[model samples]
Each structure stands twice: as C-alpha cells, then as structure tokens.
Target: MQFLLDSADRQRLSLDARPDGALTLVFDEATGEQASVAPRTLLWYKLACTLPAKLPPAIVRDYATKTFKPAQAYGALLNTLGPCR
Candidate 1:
C-alpha cells in the first residue's frame, strides 16, 4: 500500500511486509518499528481526502462498521515530512 500526499514535496508512503506476515509502514528505509492499524481507520483516512462530503457506497458496505485486525487484508498509514534544510 502507498499514498502520495498532496504536499509541496509530494511525500510518499510505502507499506511493506514483515517476516511475521504483518504489514509495516516504511519511510526513508527505516525499520524495526510497529506499524499496525485498523483497516477502517486507513480507509476512512483515504475517504476523508477523496470524498469528504459522504462515505463511498462500496467503502461503507465493505469496511465501515468492522472491528477486526484483518491484517492480511489491511495495512497501516505511515506519514513523513520532507527533509529539513
């Protein structure tokens, strides 16, 4: 999973798999950190940007109102800012 932030630098997020089969967020090649998150949380974040007015029908039916890890089917969000000068 990946996200191209709408910022001046066009920051990017890259989700990678860990040895234990859990999804992890990777930025700037750093590792050894926990990156677990709820599937709905990630979906809501995306919908917030694409459809702030209302929830998309598909998303509502599929992701909304769910409370499970579903780790195999979901990944966490990783945010990073541009390097400082």
Candidate 2:
C-alpha cells in the first residue's frame, strides 16, 4: 500500500507486505534520512487513513468488523503488556 507522506510535494511512502509475513517501508525517492517505524504503529496509521469519518458508515463498519484482524491481534498483545504507566 502507498501513502502520501508529504502533501505539498506529494512525497509517498509505500508499505510492501511480503509473502513471508514481513513488511518493508519504501520511499518514493532518496531523502537522505533514516527512519524506523514499528509494525503496530504503521497498522494504526493505515487504519486511521482508511477509516476516516468522511467515509460511509457501512464501509467503516465493514472494515472494522471484517478487515480489522491485525488491529484486534495488536490489541490482544497490548493487553499482555499490562496497564500503561
């Protein structure tokens, strides 16, 4: 999936999901910077973008109910981490 990271210049960031269950983040062009993002963070960011309020309620419900397995698993993992400080 590709996301626009910068709106002014239309800089894009891509998330490539490999067949072996790995994810790679790619930039549209060389930016001469180093960056790292956790998988869960990326997942939430994607959800935030795709499930915006401007979308129809039915679409949002379908995405949250049918396509939210990753978020659900992340939630379960967070539960095992105990309460936040």
Candidate 3:
C-alpha cells in the first residue's frame, strides 16, 4: 500500500508499504528527511489511521458484536509503534 499526504504547510509526504513488510516514509529529498518503521509498527500505523471510524460504540457493536468500542485500544496500538521497532 502507498499514499501521499499533502499538508497545509505545503509539504508532501510520501508513504510506501512493501510486500516484504517494510514501510518507508519520506518527508524531503534534498535534506534527506525520512524514516522507516518496521513491518509490525507499520501495521499499527495503518490501524491508527482508521481508528476514528471504529470510535462509535454502535458501529463497533454492529460490526464486531463487541460491547466495547475500540477507541480505547488507541493507546495500546500507538504503543506498538514504538519498542517493537
């Protein structure tokens, strides 16, 4: 998976996910402002991006049939982004 985020600050960030389980995030090319997160961390990043959609309790219960919404899982998901790297 890949995506481009154009910030209001006029910055273009290129994000790429590879089949080999690696995610590359590039901020700039001239100054080499870039970083790459491990495959697992990348997965968490993807989940975090969609967290808002699962924030509603009704939606969570309807789809997952779980009483609790996953919004509370945000912290644990975010924590996975670190240490695992």
Which of the numbered candidates is closest to the native, going by highest lDDT?
3
lDDT tens digits by residue: candidate 1, 1-84: 333233336745455544444444544445544355334566334433442233345654675455633232332222121111
lDDT of 2: 0.43
- On lDDT, the stronger of 1 and 2 is 2
lDDT tens string, model 3, 1-85?
Answer: 4546565589887765565555567788688787876545654455445433324566445644255434444333344343332
The order by descending TM-score is 3, 2, 1
Clashes of 1: 0
Candidate 2: regions farther than 4 A off: 1-9, 31-37, 42-85
TM-score winner between 1 and 2, please give it: 2
The Cα error of candidate 2 at residue 24, in Å, is: 1.6
Where is model 3 more than 4 Å wrong at Cα?
A: 39-47, 50-85
Error of 2 at 64 (Å): 26
For every model shown, the clashing-pair count is 0, 0, 0
Model 1 CA deviation exceeding 4 Å by range = 1-9, 18-21, 28-34, 43-85
